[model samples]
Target: MAYYTSNAEHPIDIVNIASLENRVKARMDRGAFGYIREGAEDEWTLRENTRAFNDLRIAPRVLQGIDHVDLSTSIFGIDLKTPIIEAPSAAHGLAHVKGEVDTAIGAAKAGTLFAMSTYGSTPVEEAAAAAPEAPQFFQLYMSKDDGFNEFLIKKAVKAGVKAIIMTVDSTLGGYREEDIVSHFQFPLPMPNLAAYSASDGVGKGISEIYAAAKQDFVPSDIAKVKDMSGLPVFVKGIQSPEDAIVAIQAGADGIWVSNHGGRQLDGGPASISVLPAIAKAVNHQVPVIFDSGVRRGQHVFKALASGADLVAIGRPVIYGLNLGGAEGVKSVFDHLNMELSITMQLAGTKTIEEIKKTTLL
Candidate 1:
């Protein structure tokens, strides 16, 4: 069963993601809000993630004579109605009553993908059932115990996940000052980690939970995950061209460029800053998934131009979920798609392929 008891009442006239975040901040408990809102020490990377995007300028062409725009694209053989998909974040119950179940439903409704975290408050099978038709993926935090790892792999496969997203970052928790000052602890159960007593991972700090995770996450684990699930494996949390190439050589079917939303490392380069080089390194050997500070349609446009095949969103979806549950989550995706379409039209790029061909200044 999923954690939590009731849903949040929908907010009125929430105009944008920023406004929605402010609304959540006003009403949510301090600790819960900070956990989602704050980043690692000094938070330079976190702040840079968006600032870097803001630095890039787009040059729109006017004479293409296009009438309609198409946002359709595919990854690992699964088609997406829009390039924006949900990046997995843990403990949705903290943001909403329905938790990951609501998130999955919202993403499904928007005709995009939702990747459920291993630390999700909802069980894998339950969330899967909530959105049976959605093309779902499982984001894994490999445990030190092989038995546990095998169990989760089998369970995710049984739930009909299309791919396995192995989060290569966060073998350990970052020095998040907010969490420490606030003494924040997960207030709800993480149903996915219920199998291990010590690792049940509720009511404890993130670092404590990470202590039970496998710290030796090497490139070979990419193939190991594929063998375990017999599905395509995406190595998420990649930020460098060198690591991107290594992941491909280790048989990764996809490269997910991220900085864990700057939650893991404080001084690292913004995920966007490193994407073009990493994409060049991969040279389209496999699909590239980019996420880390996407907030607008223009950000999506810039990422595609910079080399991302698809852009994944994190905090904005949670902001939506915090405000309106499944509907709120759907609203986030719909809004981004609307924005991306508008950007594409204004840029004279009618298709996603054309967006990829664009060059950012």
Candidate 2:
């Protein structure tokens, strides 16, 4: 029997997506594991992100005679093999030795997209170079300094990122009890920050680093980012209909529906719960991208049914990266694609278009 295992001596067998955490926990250190696992204060929204998916039931239409399922979809004129894409999560070096370089390689191998965070352990060019053919996006945390923001955006554009995903939810670090208790600080260099600051965050903590981010974000910032990068800009962290409309009106190419993976606000509604209204508000004027608490293929299906052109995974990719590096990240995407193919066939949907039309009970 062929099985996937990070360590041959330990022989940790590959299992379902939900099982990756506990398996990773057994091997990773306390602070590093906590950073990936724990969310905001009380973790109510964190837990609810997954729990709320149970509210929507998949009303599969049986016996439609669908044999082959097509998972291909296009975003911003770029084609992808699966609707599932990698979400931007900072500091992949905390999880794997290779960091986002491995992530970019894996996503490219899987024929999907990987959004690289501004705080990524690897520099934009190195990550983009890791998988030259891959469709990658840069997630920007606009710095308080205008020069730094313009410099970083131009650097990413030079590296060939297809779009800019401006994360609006996190102007500051969240009150993550786990990090506070564990006294967690990034152990490795954040070259992205170092490129401009001339410091690899030798002794500073994440909160201290976040202090340099721009606190006030106006709607015009959307157009500003686009003009800065000369690439399509997607306003991430949108949770309301009003915000969605504001973004589109401000020339946003897409509206990314996320609650910062439940890492920003503990009591806020789950990303899935708020997705419908935001999607309706955007009203297909721009693409709606979604993330947060997505573990199963059904969650991906439900999100598309609710009105998402694409769904991104954050923690799961890290889990895979921790366990198996580039191959592991590819495995994570491969498994989800397989599960989604099964869901499509069982639900009588043959294409991504059909899955979007699926009704959840």
Model 2 agreement with the true structure over 1-361: per-residue lDDT tens digits: 1212233111124668999999889988788789889899999999999999999998767779887899999998999999999999988877777789889998998899989999898999999999999999999999989899999999999999999999998898789999889898777778988999899765568688889999899999998999899899999999999999999999999999999889998899999999988888988999989999999998999999999999999999999888888888888998898888988888888998998888789
**RMSD of candidate 1 to true structure, Å:** 2.1
Q: Pick the candidate with the highest lDDT.
A: 2
lDDT for predicted candidate 1 compared with the true structure: 0.88
State the displacement of the C-alpha of residue 230, model 2, in Å, after optimal TM-score superposition.
0.6
lDDT of all predictions, in order shown?
0.88, 0.89
- Poorly placed runs, candidate 1 (over 4 Å): 1-6, 9-14, 196-200
Distance from true position, residue 6, model 2, in Å? 8.9
- The residue pairs found clashing in candidate 1 are none
In model 1, the Cα lDDT at residue 130 comes to 96
